[model samples]
Target: MSIKVIVADDQEIARTGLRMILDAQEGIEVIGEAGDGGRAVELAQRLRPDVCLFDIRMPRVDGIQATRSLAGPGVADPIAVVVITTFDLDEYVYAALQAGARGFLLKDAGPALLSQAVRAAAGGDALIAPSITARLLSAFAGAGRSAPPAQPVEALTGREEQILAAVARGRTNSEIAEEFHISLSTVKSHIASLMTKLGVRNRVEIAMWAYETNRVRT
Candidate 1:
């Protein structure tokens, strides 16, 4: 099935550009567009698309607030949201994540990465900007507020540890496979094993634990 998406941005040009990019992909569709956060939230609640792409700054309400409304921890049925913004500051990234954004991408991350981020968010993965991920996660680790101290590393095998470290570094499955000279299925198996061992739901939580536990340095 084609992945349905909603584009929410105050600027018409931005929405159009994103739509063009997503529509060019064979298995993705842009179902709706909203110019403000309130409309974005309303449409999201109504349409229930697979993914919602939101800009940080919008009239009436902000993307963070909209994200929280749709995907916050308290929301019984949370929609996956990918926050697109011009800012790469740690505070903005952290705030968006806290608001339940599944992924973060800079506005200029290009169509390829933007599309990948949307698909990743929909698949319960994360696709943070490389620069942003390195800097922000490093700072979050240094702040020492995100993760608890490293517990026993568990019984993770060598391959699982390697995959977990790559995940912590924000490397996608394909990238990890390429880097390790392994097949995509093998990479996924390692990820599944790592997730089970670490007791995490998604890659974002794995990345968070990596930072908090000081396992993968920024």
Candidate 2:
């Protein structure tokens, strides 16, 4: 089945380019386009697309607001959202991820990453721009960067700890499985456990928590 997507941006040209890029990808379709967050939310709630590709700055509502409406915590049956923006500023990246975005990509992330983000989001996986993954976290860590990260909720098994480190480094589940010589389902189980233990909603948050706690060092 095709992965349906909604593209939302304040600029018509940007929206058009994003739509074109997504439409050209195999198994991906841009089903709707919205110039503002209000319409973006309305179309999303009604159309129920597989993914939402949103720009951070919009007229009525920004991408973060729109994303929160569709996918934030406490939202039941949330839609998948991937934020694509020109700004790779720390605030925007953190805000979008905290708003429950499944992925974040720069406008210059190129067609390959754009399509990959859509596919990953549609498949219930999270992707942060590789170029920003490690640096984005460590750059903002401050003086606490050297401190060891505290374990969360409960003690993590040795395997879980390894999984957490792998995830913190932005490795996909398949990659983690390959690295650890485990099954894909096993990797997923460990990730799910990590999310529960860390009190996070997604892998992006998992990575953030690791960085914040100094678990994943520079």
**Top TM-score hit:** 2
Candidate 1, superposed: residue stretches over 4 Å from native: 142-156, 181-186, 189-199
Q: Name the runs in model 2 displaced over 4 angstroms.
A: 139-151
TM-score of 1: 0.82
> Against the hidden reference, what TM-scores do the models get?
0.82, 0.91
Model 2 per-residue lDDT tens digits across residues 99-190? 88887888999899899888888988877777777777666543333564446889899999898888878777777889999999998899
Cα lDDT, all candidates: 0.82, 0.85
Across 57-167, the per-residue lDDT of candidate 1 in tens digits comes to 899988989998998777998899998888677455666676788778889999889889988888767787776776776666535344454453477788877887888
**Candidate RMSDs in order:** 2.8, 3.0
